[model samples]
Each structure stands twice: as structure tokens, then as C-alpha cells.
Target: MDPVLDDHMHLDPVNGRGVEACEEFADHGGTHLLVLNKPSWHYGVEVEEGGDFQTAYDHTVDVVRESNEVLAGRAWPVLGVHPALISQLVDRGYAPEEARDLMRAGLDTAAEYVADGRALALKSGRPHYEVDEAVWEASNEVMRHAFALGADLGCAVQLHTEDGEDFTEVAEWAEAAGIRREHVVKHYSTGGVVGPTPSVLADREELVRAAERGIPFMMETDFIDDPDRPGAVLGPKTVPRRTRWLREEGYDGALERAHVETPRMVYGIDTRATLE
Candidate 1:
């Protein structure tokens, strides 16, 4: 059987259902997941300095560790500064350059976790929402810093970006930073990226459309796991359930590539081994 994996999901033990969501995914046949840290603000960590991000990052690592200890399958952690932190810092009277420095420093801390094998990948990106040109440029700088760190750590980088991003310019940044294009993934992506691999959301028609493009890609639910808005951006069970739906629709080959081959290439994780 092809191992089912969710490329992006969150577990907020404090504010949400937490590991119970993992149980839901597992119950529905998920074999593996990449658990990411929520933004620092969500954890009530006022980012005065880069070291402040350690609290949120540590929480995420602990959550993944606990989830792995309980789950029969596996969970890998992804940690980094959320790109929207730029606006938060500026709103609190930070200069764009200062915000950029803080975010880069935060990613440096995240890279430390990756280097120590406490996390599997680093997550960073520019704001998906619009901002001033200076903030946008600063956000890109922070994102490029992530790519550079990924090159040094030899781990994949997951990006949260605006919809319809072609990623042509991002490909240049990856190359200049010495990280492979495929090593950068667009999380919550609906395809159409030219450079970074697309971690496509688990929608049948969208999956079919992405798979038909003949580029490497993977599937994700981007499950937020918030109690206030349960099942937002799809649910915990969406990936495995969608995998079953695709298999039923005779897309077995595509499923194998998405669930197994593509993840191994991009994340260096073999879901087959995790399943075993």
C-alpha cells in the first residue's frame, strides 16, 4: 500500500484539539505527517528578539515528539518564523529592516533545530497578504535567508505564499542561495508554481490538475487544528481520505508518486519506511 502523508499540519495543545487531531488522521489511515509550529503570537510570545522564538519552536518540537511517541506511524517537526511576523513587528513600532533582521535571526534559531535533528525542515515565506513595498522586500529577504539555511543544513524549506505565485523569481533566489528548486515547497499551494515544488491542497480536481502537469508534487491538508474554526483549510483526515478517493478513481500511480516518491525527493523522508 502507498503510505499516506500530510505535508503540513498543526497541533495546538493549548488552544485546540491537539494530538486528538493526530489520532483522527491516524484513524483515517495517515501514515506520516510534518507538524509545523504556529506563529509566535499564537503562543503569546512577544518577539522582542530572535531568541524569543525559541519558546514557540520548543513547543513545536515537544508536540512532535509527543505525537511521535503516541502515534504508531511518525511525525516530523518543521519550525521557523512566520512571515507575517513582519507586520506584527511593524505594528508594534519596529522598522522594516529591524523586523527583517529579527526574522532572519529567528530562522537562524530554527536552523539550529534542523542542524541538531530536532526538526526535519524549516518553514518561511513572505506575507501571503499584501503589504508595503519595503515590508514585502524585507519579507523576501527573510525568506531568502531560509533558503540559504536550507542549503547549509541540506533540508527542505516549506513556503507559505500568496495564491497564483509563479515562483519564477523564487527559483532564482533558490539557485543563488544554493538550494535546489525542488527542495523549496509551496505549502497550501493550488499548483501553477514554476520553481518550488507544490505541496498541493487535497482537492480531487486540483490534485488531478497538478498531477497532469508532469512535475513532482505532494499532497497536504494544511490543517490548522483550531477549535474556534474546526476543520479550517480542510481537516486532519483529508489527506488519507483523499488518497483513498484517488485510488478509487484509478489514480494509483499518481498516489504512489505523491505519497512516496515526491516526499522522499523533497523532504528526504521515506514514508514507506515510516509505515513499516
Candidate 2:
């Protein structure tokens, strides 16, 4: 069996099933996972409470660290403020400047975690491409902070963004921020275009096309870990399950490259992959 890795998933203290989810993944033949924090819409994380972002940011850091502990060296953490959180704050009457300030603080804290060896990458980027000017600019500034931090710390960033015309535009953004092109990733990529970070959730046909493209990429489910939705984004076993299927169909080379080598090179996450 080829050791498989999930490059992205959310399992915060809000849902309270993150650890169990990781355990289930390992039990199902997964080798590694990257745990992400849910900044909003999980538990009582509304920004209207207490001293605001710092408290939540600290809590998220703890959440990621604890997730690593639960996985017992099988997983690492990707920390940041999701762009949706900032955009919603703006819609909730917070000024764009205020929203950007909070996001910068969150990115700074994530970078500190990387420094401490507690986390691997910063999960930061705009939610989509069609946002209003003010919201878009604020998210861009916040992500700029994340990019600069990733560059300084030699870490990678997983971007959650909407559809766009050209993926190279993203690479240009990373260059302008002084971050390496390999350090930037487009999360939940559909494999519709050629880019560096196309860990696609597309169908078998699209994935085979991506396989033909042969540009190094990773695979993910973006499993939201929401009990209410119950595998809303994707089932937990999706990647490894596909990995096993690939093995059966003689796509082991593709699995090893995308599931192991690409993630290790791009995000610095190395799993215990053994040749079968």
C-alpha cells in the first residue's frame, strides 16, 4: 500500500471530533494529515465576545498543537485566520482597517507557531475572487502579511480562493510578497488549469487528466469536520481510498509522487512512505 497524505482538513475544538477523525484516518491506512483550525461557525467563536481576535487566535494555536499531540507525530498543523472570518467582520460593521489588523495579528501568531516548530504552514488567502473592493483589499493585505511571514520562516502557505483566469497571477503575487513560488498553494484546486498547487477534489476523469499533466501536486478532501454536515466537503477516507484504488489500477507512481513527494517538497511535511 502507498502511504497517503491529506494536505488539508479542518478539525478544531469547535467540532470536538478532530482527534477522533485523525485516528479514524490512520486506522484506514492514512499516513499523514494536516489539521486546520476553524475560526468561525464552530462552537462559540463569534468575534463579538471578550477582547476579540487574540483570545480566539491563542485558542486556535492550542487547538492545532493539541491535534498534533493526538495524532502522535502522524500529523502537523496549518494555522491562520480564514478570510471568511475577516469578510464577515466587515459585514458585521467592523471597519476594513480593523479587520485587516485582526488578520495580521492572527498571521503573526501562526508564524510564531512555525518558529516554535509547532506548525508547518500558514493557511491564508482570500475566500473568493468576486469580493467587494474593501473586503478584497483587506483580505489581500492580511494575506500579504501571511506571505511575508512564510517567506521569512521558510514555510509554505495554502491559499483558499475563488475561481480566476490565470494561476500564474498567484505565483506573481507570491513573488511580489518576496515568498518563493513553491511556498504558495491554491487550496481546493479543481484541476481546471495548470498550477503548482492543484491538490484537486475533481472526479476520476479530471484527476487522470491532472495525472497526465504530470505537474507535481497534492491531494485533499478539505474535510470540514462538521458533525452537522457530516463529511460535507469530502469524506475523511477520500484521499487514501483513492490512493488504494490507484495502486490497484497501477497508478502507484502517481500516488507516490503526489501523496508523498510533492507535499514533502512544497509544505515540508514528510510522511513514513514505504515502497510497496
Candidate 3:
């Protein structure tokens, strides 16, 4: 098998390191780097000239734009509305209604970029710090909009569920919201609903149910090599080992078949090698 695609990676070069990492990834024969955009710390703040904020939702769009401009088709933009930052949307200075509207507009703009062949996928699934019913509801609303746009644009939607229960709830809500399971992909299944440990054996059964229901599941490490990041909970070395383990446990062929052949058929991702 070819070097697996790094399905999700966050390499913002606000300080120049991100660009270097992108070059290194491309040099390593990585076909695509899905750059998941998160709001920059400088979002909502005034910046000097040439320091424009271009993040998809807030500061993230700028990063995507720069990366795409620099990488020239080697990078794919993945717009993510991190769960922990939901409150930031309605914080003191920001208007709740206006922020939500801006978010929708941002997603629409991102979707348009993807539709125009400028990006790859529209993804969601960053970790949440303090989730509640309201947060889930808000996130569901965002997901509904993203799925609708993605379906029309022929792009894929990535979901990050905390655990078994959260996954179940998200699935049910997504179905009720009219999001097709075929267009939604789950990321990082090994992370338990509540923590970074391997999912319970029973949760594996639940995953099978999800798979049988048509939801395309894809695994990813949130960050590439940052131990301080949440994806590090499983440890960097552990990620590939888990991938190998899962493959040995009877899902390798299934994963390859689903994400490779079927995903290409459904999402139009090219499986053939093309000289750039």
C-alpha cells in the first residue's frame, strides 16, 4: 500500500514552521495534507498591514489561503469549528446571533472554495473542553449546515465524536437533521468517548453498527508530532501501532476498501497516481 494520506493535520505557519512542515510532508510522498483550520489566537484582534486575519471561521481562513497559495494544490483545506470555542462565538464583545451567522457564512464561503476545486474537504471534530446539551445542539446545527453544503458541493464532512454515547447522539441528530451517512466520515475511532484510551469492546460493536449504517469511518491523529496536543494522549508512537493493530484485527482490508475504493467512488478523491 502507498504511504497513507495524513487525513487530518494542523500545521499553521504563523511563525514559519508550518510552511517548512508542509514542504517536508510533500517530500515524504504524502499525497495530500488535509489542513484542519482552527481560529488563530489573533482572531478578532486588529493586526498591522500584511498581518491580515484570514482563517475560515475567524483566524483560520488566512492560514488556509496562505497554505494553498504556497503549496499550490498539495494541501487541502479543512474548516473546523472547534467545540471548545463555541462560547467564544458569543463572548462579551461578539454578538451571539451575529457570530453564528458569520460562522455559517464562513462555512458557505469555504464550501464555495471547495466546490471550485480549491479545497478538498469540510471537516469538524476538534476536542471540546466542557460540553453540554446546549453545546451539542449548537454543534449539531453547524453540522447540519456543513452537511447540506458539502452534499451539494460533492465534498465530504468529517465528524469527531467524543465517545460511544456522543457518537450515537451525533449520529441520531445528524440523521434527523437530514445529513446523509454516506457523506459523513467519523475520525479517530480508537479514542474512547470520554478519553484517549482504546474504545471499549462493546463500543466496537457500536462502530460496526455505524459502519453498517453507511457512515464512512476514518482514523486520524489530531496533530502530527505535538505531544502537548490532545491527539498526543495516545502518544505519537502509539498511533501507527494502533493502525497496524487495527489492520491485523481484521479492519485493514475493510479500511482500505472503504476509504480507498468506495470513498473515491463517493467523494471523487483520485486513487490513481497523477504526475503533478
Candidate 4:
């Protein structure tokens, strides 16, 4: 088997012992592993300990930095707010005004991290934040800001959308807002608030439709082995099969062209690195 590129995985130096896991993954046939910066609370940070928020951010940074060293340049880091954390950013620490300010600063910090080449993608989820119509609109507003920053920074936007909503809404908005097709990618995880099964039948239809329209798309397993985690439903060993299925389903050709051919044309990445 050729080395598989796992595009979306979260590595926490503070928990799940990601450094060791990453080394093991590389030793066992993984070629590239993309890590996303997640909230400290996800790793069990106590709310009372000032949460060591800076330490959490630094921890995520260090993991990516070290992973790059270990992999000899195969690690790709993605930094952005998880949609669930968006409300927390504004509703948690300060007066409503102050909270909004802090949230903006936090996003700026994320941008700076990306500017340093620590992030290859900006990760966000729509289903996590869209609890109501107002929240849905607000979620788009937030995504607009994030997308703008991501575009300026030369990073891709990885979006998580509900299965049924017209994701073309996203593509259309991006086009209207001047975001290029190459800069936006959608992650179709297998299960969760938004996954393959839960995805509206219509959404799946739209994905096929979008492909016909020449939109860039990708499928990700988003699998985690921890039994307590929601993603564990899609076991690790199931990843390859899922990839094969997506390929059989037609999303493969486009994704391969983007990750393999197009990147080579633009960045001079050796296509041999993607050989299977």
C-alpha cells in the first residue's frame, strides 16, 4: 500500500500522548498527518486553573513543531476555532463587549499562528453552531471572517456542514465574497452532528451536483479509536475502506487531482509523494 495521507486528525501533546502516536503512525505507513488545534478543555483542562490557555496554545504549537521534526517535514497543522468554541469565546470570560473583543483577539492569534506556517487549513463546523436560525446566520458571519483571514494567509478552509443543507450556499457565498474554489474544501466525516448517515439525502445529492459544477471537495473519516469519543464509531481500521468507497463513489478523482496534481503545479510538491 502507498503511504496514506490522513488530512484531518487532532493531536494533543497534553492528552492521548500524540507525540508517541504520531511516531507510531509514521512507522506504520502513514505518510502525512494533519493536526488541528483544539480547545484546552477537550484535553481536560480545569476551568479554575486559568485553564493555562496560553500553555494549551503553546502545547498545540509544540506538537506540530516537533511532529514536523519527527516526520522530517510531513506534518501539516490546521489552526482555527471549533464552532462550538465560538460561543464560549464570546459568552465566557468578560462583559458582552469585552467577550467579543477577546474573541477577535483569539482569532487574530490563530491567524498569526497560521502566518508562521503552522497551519495549512482553517477548520470550522456549521452544524455545531447552528442551533437556531439566528445562530445559523451568526455562524455564517463568523465563517465569513475566518474565510477572509484564511484566504489572505494562503490557507485552505475546511468546512463541516450538515448533510442536507445546500452546501452550494457555502460555495456560492465564497464566490460572491471572492474566495477561490481552490481555497475551500469540505470535510464529510462519517458520523456526528454531521456525518455520512446523518447528512441529508439532499446534501449527498448536492455533493454530487457540486462535483459536476467543478467544485473542489474531499472526504475524511474523522475517526478516533477512543471508545468515549463520538468519532470512535468509525474505527481506525475502517479509514482505508472509507477512502476506497469515496473513490468508488466519484469524489476520488477530484480530490486526487487537487492533492496530487494541482498542488504540484502550484507549489512544486513532488507527485511521487502521493503514489499509492
Candidate of highest TM-score: 1
Per-residue C-alpha lDDT of model 3 across residues 9-113, encoded as one tens digit per residue:
666555334555555544544444456764544334431211222443333445555555544234456664554445665554544445445555556766766
* lDDT score of residue 11 within candidate 3: 62
Models 1 onward score TM values of: 0.97, 0.88, 0.65, 0.69
Better of 1 and 2 by TM-score: 1
lDDT of 3: 0.50
Which parts of model 2 are misplaced by more than 4 Å?
A: 48-73, 273-276
TM-score of 4: 0.69
lDDT of 1 by residue, 20-125 (tens): 8988888888878899999988878898877999988887887787788656569999999888899989999999999999999999999999999999999999
Q: What 10-residue stretch in candidate 1 is worst by lDDT?
A: 64-73
Q: All models: lDDT?
A: 0.88, 0.72, 0.50, 0.52
Instruction: State candidate 3's TM-score.
Output: 0.65
Candidate 4 RMSD computed on C-alpha atoms after optimal superposition onto the true structure: 5.9
- Among residues 3 or more apart in sequence or in different chains, the pairs in candidate 4 whose N, CA or C atoms overlap within 3 Å are 163-199, 163-200, 164-200
Candidate 4: misplaced stretches above 4 Å?
1-3, 43-55, 69-73, 87-102, 189-219, 224-227, 230-255, 262-276
Please give, for residues 1-276, the per-residue lDDT of candidate 2 as tens digits. Answer: 455788887765555576667766766777677777677545465665323444544555666566555443466677777888876777888898898887787688777778898777888888674677888888888887888888899888888877652578767778887887766878787655554467677356656766767667777888887778887688777877877776787776777778777887888665653222
Q: Sort by lDDT, best first.
A: 1, 2, 4, 3
- The candidate with the higher lDDT, 1 or 3, is 1
